[model samples]
Target: MSRLITLVTAMIATITTPALSQTCPPPLNGAVRLVLVTAPDMESTGGLLQLFARETPAHAWTPASTPHPVRLGKHGLAWGIAFEAYKRGDEREKTEGDKCTPAGFFRIGPSFGFVASERHNYITIKPGETVCVEDPASPLYNTITQRVQLAPETKADNMADTSLFRNGLFVDYPSDRANKRGSCIFIHIWKTPDTPTSGCVALPEPQVKALQQFAEGGAVLAVIPQTARDRFPTCLPDMSAPHDP
Candidate 1:
């Protein structure tokens, strides 16, 4: 009987080991700078955003900026189009019109603002020219294009919306139009402290500008819900730390 029990125990462990080890790891990809966002769960419309930086992969992530309150998608978060979570078919994937912000690591880059930068690929949102195509059926979906160049029927964000996007960083979410994973995700200004966004992360005007200055072209952003935060890398900062500005 003792021998039989031992055999059964060993079999159980073998069967469950793979499941236990399959926890999705943070896909930082050697990022030296990071913007980490976390919410309570899939239905939360707000969360905390913090920044961390390191010299290299071997260096520890030190706090770059203190935690700040940010408004999230009205419907909460879903697994992003990138990384293991969506590929494994284990979580709800972010899709077009889901009203949920995508959770994953993404690159931050070339800014968009009222003024253009001759030194960088910074987009200058011209009132009549700029538009971000959100229509999945359009061949130019997910791209920023000129209104005069696109079909007159194309549906897109004006991009010149000074109210919400006077200045912001484009979150390089790997959403494909064919997949209709999602589109137009960004870290722009919020309308109010308590207002929720339509699938993008929204911050205060100052923070949005500061983030653009800090991003420096290749910063990675990780958006994880509280339940899954522990599985990611250990760069998460302690919220209790006294560093708010």
Candidate 2:
């Protein structure tokens, strides 16, 4: 009986050991499960600079506030920067020193597209201006306005936008919050290879394809901060920073 018991124990250990060893590894290449970032960044640029994880899309995006995590656009990448909170007409007043990007999540695409500037092709928003949701009458009224747009030839090259955004993807802004403050936020290819976006996330075609692979149904762009990640289970830590873990 003792010998039989020993044999059974050994078999059980062997089976269990392999199962435990096969746990999923950390996100590949420190890839972010979601986008989180500051308020100002979110408003100025459609891309979120931070990251997070959640079962549902986030309604609010804040640098210091982590919301839920959702996949990004097939050709979309998020922007990075912490700015201060300020109303429209305050663009000059708000600076990198303030570290604000608003604090809310907005629905994303439903029509995204790429623009042909005659000279080159660029990713364009859903036409019209993107404004703060709270602020009506903005060019992007009833949609995302006052936001910035990065053309394929300007800069903010990530390689993904040029290849993937050849056709462009629809954008769905999160529900609620200020919009119409600006418009035309996008991630497109650029002339300068090393140029950063006015405030949009930029990527190459391969990255966009990778994004589509992960996003099953669809995806959302959540912008928050590293500190916010600690507050919410859905929120992910900021990994875009230099030498992040």
Candidate 3:
């Protein structure tokens, strides 16, 4: 009887280990809310983004909402200064105008939209007047501010009239002051299912709105490549290679 019990216990452990390993990792910083974005592969610009909720840190993550289809950068995935940089060497690091979406964990920044929502923390954009500063030399670099607030000589990308910026969630990238890490990363409305973005993650307007409604304080976003999903947050990229310029 003792031998049977031991064998059964070992069998249960063996069966459950792989299953547990396949579950999505916990939200960063112990956040109860998470947005999980998973692509088919590192080079694919299309994927699924899902919102997850956990009652407590000890509980497993459960889907808070349906999976939403999303479009990524035209050039696909690349390393960024945020979560990826810590895991992988900067060999394939993203740079300004690289057109590759930075893949890693991120804290969802302030929500913005042309229309206002009282439920979420939203920043309203003034068409033709709002701009997201991408110029590295400017004090407002990698930030969204009113054109009036910028220095007279500062050059910035006007985001006021763009549909992509009409409704969006900023992904905190280039968390440091270094200019080479890239800028203006966001999750925004896509033009179409076939359309890809400059670097932001794009979803339909309805989906974007849904995300805005579901996301709350202490939310985190984790972009996981399909190839790395199983081994993520554990098997990091090789760090020996020199960083890209």
By lDDT, the best candidate is 1
Poorly placed runs, candidate 3 (over 4 Å): 1-27, 84-91, 177-179, 233-245
- Candidate achieving higher lDDT, 1 or 2: 1
Q: Could you report the Cα RMSD, in angstroms, for every candidate shown?
A: 8.7, 13.4, 7.3
lDDT of 1 by residue, 1-245 (tens): 99999999999987865531133344474677888887876668888898888787545678888788888888888888755443333556889999988887787767788777652677888998988888998887777778987888888889886578898878878788888988888889998988898998899999988888788657888887776656554545455322111
lDDT of model 1 at position 148 = 86
lDDT of each: 0.77, 0.33, 0.72
Ranking of predictions according to TM-score: 1, 3, 2
Alpha carbon deviation, residue 36, candidate 3 (Å): 0.8
Candidate 1 Cα deviation (angstroms), residue 100: 1.0
lDDT of 3: 0.72
For model 2, residues 78-114, the per-residue Cα lDDT tens digits are 3221212312232332122122232323323432334
lDDT of 3 by residue, 1-245 (tens): 99999999999987766532243343354667778777776677788777877776545677777676788889887766744533443335677788888877777888888876675557888876778887777778888889998887777878776878888888766444455678889889998898888988888888887777677475777776676655564322222111111
Model 3, position 167, has a per-residue lDDT of: 81
| Model 1 local distance difference test score | 0.77
